[model samples]
Target chain A: MLFRIIKRTDLTGTQAVMFRTAAVFLALLTSSVFIIILGNNPFEVYASMLEGSFGSVYGIKETIIKTIPLVITSLGIAVAFKMKFWNIGAEGQIFMGAFAASYFALNHADIPRPALLVIMAAAGFLVGGLWALIPAIFKAQFGTNETLFTLMMNYIALKWVTYLQYGPWKDPGANGFPKIANFHDNAILPKVFGVHIGWIIAIVLIVIMYVFIHHTKRGFEISVIGESENTARYAGMNVKKIIITSILISGGICGLTGMIQASAVNNTLAVEVTGGVGYMAIITTWLAQLSAPVILLVSFLFAVLVQGGAYIQTAFQIPQSVASIIQGMILFFVLGSEFFIQYKLILNKSILKKEAKGGI
Target chain B: MDFALLFAYAVHAGTPLLFATLGEMVTEKSGNLNLGVEGMMLMGAVMGFQVGIATSNPLLAVVGAAAAGALGGLIFAFLTVTLRANQVVSGLALTIFGTGFAGFFGQKLTGKIVPGPITTFFGEAKVPLLSDIPFVGKILFAQNLFVYFGYVAAIALGVYLFHTRKGLNLRAVGENPAAADASGINISLYKYTHILLGGALCGLGGAYLSLVYVPTWKENITAGRGWIAVALVIFTTWSPYRAIIGSYLFGCLDIIGFRIQDLKIKVSPYIIDMLPYIVTIVVLVFISMRKSKENAPPKGLGNPYFREDR
Candidate 1:
């Protein structure tokens, strides 16, 4: 018998929608099971999570606040992912970016706030881009594996930041905690209305990146590179240049994310300032399938889950680990659904034997 | 402060890394890099700690940890092997799962410390006349079981890969799976079994952390030793003996750093701490830049093998 690959478009339009709906619903169902396993009433826990995240006016604002950094970092990751460059060190890059930005903010306190902030942003972008560039350079020049390189770089960056936090950048008066002095008013990011300046930057970035990836010629080349580097090369697109350029851009945006998270939102840099958002951003980006605007939708829901998790913990005494578990579960189903999209489960030899034996 | 004491500490620290690197070496030789070793190590560390805590039997705890780590590897092999999932994603997911699971489980076992396995934690097992030797005996012969095992594994695995038939076949699978498949070797079986074995060894490495090195169970006792294991796999170019040398070097650097942290070394602790990762990165870059490096990764490394593709 000739083996045939299953066609993805074999299902009807409505069935396709139903499949997606059921998949997402299944994820929610599994998430509820986790809540139940943790010894909490699923409905009450979920309801309280919803209430805590969005029931009050301030809750929604906080959720929005959390979204800014995540959206920014994820959009950067999406750009790199689109080019098939796996930069898992974005967390460390963000740390480096914050460190670089904070250093400038500290040394250049004599400069006007607006100028200082711009310089800080530029420095962060440069540091982040350079951090990413190290791996990109390795990949382009020496064929070094970017994934491991980036991962290693993360530890290096983390240590670099920690060394400072524990030594030079340590809060001089606050005993021995790993934190830095707050930036001056000149370097502090200004808020617009109740929304964080980071959120405003995030919105502007989303629109620009969407246009860059979808409309521009360079963006078009990035998609080609991701599809097949050889094919892109055959088409005379400079694959190395594009990969390096895309990564630089991606890493730079992540730097801006670090700067904003430090200066605008938290007001000071801490070890957890990145808050593992950079890694979760990878999951969010993949869930959105790297669609620039879809990040907003996914991030919105992610923020809610995180917000809800805080509520669940406070209200039900559940471990904060529940949020991480829920994220993992969501990622599980989303990733698993790709199997259905790409391949059909056919009745193989044993299954065929079962069907033959079925008298009914 | 003496060479003998310093040498013993290096051996103790390097032993687990040696095992972990060797385990990763075997897997990479088969052309599948397992980044989940960190997660596996953490799981082993925690599980070993918990079992040792519950039963007070360190040997049984190592066994438990080895089994748990093998199970973790099986999960990785299943995902990348059976499902044809992206190996990197699956390995990463395994790390995530392993990390999260270990953290959750380890919460109960936190701050639980046990006595050091040996009388002085890392004393000796010296040969009769050798123990009296000035510098040589203390450094090489007088040490823990784990240290001896690490050397034995390095030598044994080195012999097996280069000098044995089964080892050749596994290397064959790594070098070119398609050709190996043509030669009627069971690529999938070799990969799955060795991967699990590698996982078990990695589990042992992790268990060593709790059982021997620190003699305490904590949330992240293994820390990032797993990543160092991955780096060592590459650093050694899959050489078993080189793994021992690399791990000891790393261990020595780390030990020395801690020993001299109080001395104003003109370098910040942060920059000093950054040395290992930076060194790893630089070494990898150097490895990549070498034009004549023939024993690079296996030819078919990381690419999924499907008979149908032929």
Candidate 2:
């Protein structure tokens, strides 16, 4: 049968939500094929995944820890993406931020606890913002392709951290093992009820970002620039300044994630500080459609997938990559479902009749 | 350090990159910025290695790799071309999927060796007269069949992209799809064909790594070479011929750290590892500063086209 695709201009909110939900269901159903191939029952494997992620208090805590970075970094990415700036260097920014925070933590352990924590946060924010600023300046001044430029920066940042881990920052007490020294008590972030203060910080930022993006004048300028740089300029916006400012905020927030992860989770900075969270945040940020509230929901769901994926690796003797495979499938199905939301396919009756008559 | 051997090894190391850059260049020339080269290469590497082990045939392995890569390309094309999804996000999703797919299957193949016959089949053979030349001969003429194919592919792609009528039509589509559509060019056909062709070449590049470079299966065997290839496409300004130089230069950068260590130079290996990425950023800045129109990306690049929207 012949088919024609037509754009749908009248999609309702409920319909869009239904499409996404169906896409997610389809992703799980398809990934079950792989689970079956691995000689496991699909339902049991999926049940194990759910049990693993939310089954126990520890499992729940680990999921939240993963969610913390995902949420913070996604929020940061949303800012630059709102201006169509494609800042793909969150990985690099996170590393630089962790490095900067670690430097002060290691050298000045004598500072008071609250004061040291504040300084580390400031250091991460500044260093991460500056690391991102290099590309922003090049982009504004020369119109360089930010996508590839930011990507290159990720490696550079990674190598820098690697250098520090094996060279200067190598703990002298570890008997030649290449690892950074653990943070002093003053350098660590205190826990709230059960988790690190990062969760509290995450919620606060969500509120601030919601207000900044939808209610503020600068945020309105950002949307205008995203729509069309020419239109923003016509409306007397300083386009270059806005781009630089938004990226600084974006990169700074990512840097804060690095500091939190290092001080709270790892208790020491290393090359694995970001652990692919930087790249994954891009996905969550996009899936969230650049909305603060939606980012929280999406990141939480993604964390469940990650935590469950990790759990299945041991429980079922399955490889850790099954989780990655499932995540990829979900992304693909969700991405494809967007097309259905925006357009509809119709059967072409005339073409079908012609084909039935065997006419060329 | 032996300079001659370094150059030879640089050319050997660069062969896979040349293939990937050429593939991505073709895809981008059709106005689709697929950022899934790393994932596609991994898929090719794993599939090629598996087929090589199964059939003990080098040719079949390569074909398998290319087919696997094309499958990856097909997924990307369906999303970005037919579904009109955001190109950047869709490409990232493809990369994630490809990485997982390769990792899952490749886990069993770890430490397995390629069959003896396939290894011998890919072994180096020197060109008689060409191998006799002092510096250039050793670097270019004396290499395995896979490396030789890289040279041919580079020249062939250059001719196809710049000199052929079909190539011109493809470029027109990338530069201005609405105009190309108005002129009766099949924009979707050109995009799908080029994108698939691009994916196949990327697969070959991945196969080169597993079947030729290392001759074994390893998770993430591409080791960000796919990403380096993506950067090289921009570094070479979408020209296949320039890709040869860019790939080898990066290849030299890749091995220079090892060469330095052999010479007892005190430089940190990590610092040396950072050179290629740093150079790409610097070169990108310089290229953008020049503001050369010819060096810019396609006008319609990264935007989904709908004849009705126009």
Candidate 3:
């Protein structure tokens, strides 16, 4: 496991920074609770998050590779999320990529590298985008709840992939289970300089996206739509178009991560295709304030937390679910902390206690 | 498969969704969309099993699940209402918290059956002579007490939402909190009360699963029923009666497909399992076709209401 970096966002002022600090402190306290539950020191569990992610060469490399997909997928969601679109089904979109890669690997096992890679990547992106389009179109046009819509999209995507892996798309030669075919040597991503090439692509995409978000008209329009649909509409922005396009791109990248996992890392698909990266990406992007560059750091931090979770489990015999718990706590603190960053708390003890006593 | 058998299982499958959707409808009517229904249901499943095991009473155990579910909602309310946090984030947090909380706590509670009500309640639900009726009576009327309550809740909630004065205020709050506030409605209290009450109902739905439907406590027992209920809120246009229809449709769709699998039909179980979610997305497409201002969510569904948004 890797000790990944979590992006530290600038809160813009010193005195106002107390909320973010308190959030981290609360997260620390929450992790300590797990430490107590695991029969270990709370400080140790946190140190373990750092130590496990960056403690060894292999761990660091793993963290780097894991962050690649996270960065890419999170960036995808970040594009929409920054505009407050809340595309929570990136995991399912990632599955689309994995499913596509698996399909390509099975169908064209003898294809050449460039041709296969291009087709597989495009297919993954398109499928992811299409998967996202279903919900986005509905959300943009049907008044359906996007959160629920995207969530349902996730299950559908998982089951769709499951159907294939278990049925006609199921690996014919392998025993029962939802296993996809192996990506052949040509289809598999070639590691350059001993690091996964997919990571390189992710890095490139980050720079490009950073430019796109800051320098482009579409990005500005996204912010407008997010701020208010009425305003965006008044400004002549095609709000639905933006929602659809953004979600589709987001889904496409999620698909790219799936393809990377299927071809570069796992070389096959499983239920863990997205590996909870979809939700993790949400937290990462949120941490980075939806800034493209910040995603890199935030992704790394989460990678460590996830990878270290296993170590803590082994060391203390704690259920690996502890990692998820810590994750939840972090998100809780991060989200709660933002309240402080945005709004200062007033200690009107008399009013609060009075309200409390009045049975409100 | 015999129509009677298919019908029976459909009723069974729909029970949890029935309970959850009704709960969400009530909450939404009161102007709060409690996205924590999934969390509430999950806690309900675990708590119901644990409590039922200790007390050896199915009804009492169900009450425990309801209470636990209410607690889950209460936490969400504390955050979103009193604490005035983001509703969407708070709801999502509740789900994450509940998921992890259940996973950690459920390690022991899972796999153990409660002492009572495995088959007794399901077995005892048949009417004296009504059981002899053809497809209509068997499919519609006969079931456990929970199923009957689901139907009653649907009708009763429908009336309470549309007929009553309080229901009008609730609708007023959901549509525009500012308007409701201007009208002197106590916004936070109604939101908290309905959200918690909705949670209790969701918990009961979850309890129905362990105590009556599945007759066992299974990990992930709610199994996206919460998600289904979340969608039902949209599908029903936030209406209690429509929610009932939507939930039952999903429930029936869920069972009919699965029954084919149990009968060892040639279709892929994976594909069959995908039916409900896939269909929901497809329906979402149809719904999205009209997703303009006329039929959209209340303007303030997800935004946290602040007395100071001005």
Best by lDDT: 2
- Regions of candidate 1 where Cα sits further than 4 Å from its true position: A1-52, A176-178, A349-360, B115-133, B261-264, B308-310
Cα misplacement distance, residue B65 of candidate 1 (Å): 0.5
Question: Per TM-score, what order, best first?
Answer: 2, 1, 3
Candidate 1, residues B7-86: lDDT per residue as tens digits?
77787788888888888888888878777898788778778777877776657787888888888788778766655655
lDDT of 1 by residue, A304-331 (tens): 8889888777888776666655655555
Best by DockQ: 2
For all the predictions, what are the DockQ values? 0.42, 0.76, 0.41
Report the C-alpha lDDT of model 3 over B176-231, residue by residue, as the tens digit: 89889999999988888888888888988888887777766667778778888877
Tens-digit per-residue lDDT, A84-202, candidate 3: 77788888899887887778877887888889988888988998889888767766665666776788778878878777766676676676755666667888888987777987899
Clashing residue pairs, backbone N/CA/C < 3 A, model 2: none
Model 3 ranges off by over 4 Å = A1-18, A31-41, A138-145, A192-195, A229-244, A347-360, B30-34, B117-123, B127-133, B261-267, B282-299
**Better candidate by lDDT, 2 or 3:** 2
Clashes of each: 2, 0, 14
Model 1 local distance difference test score: 0.79
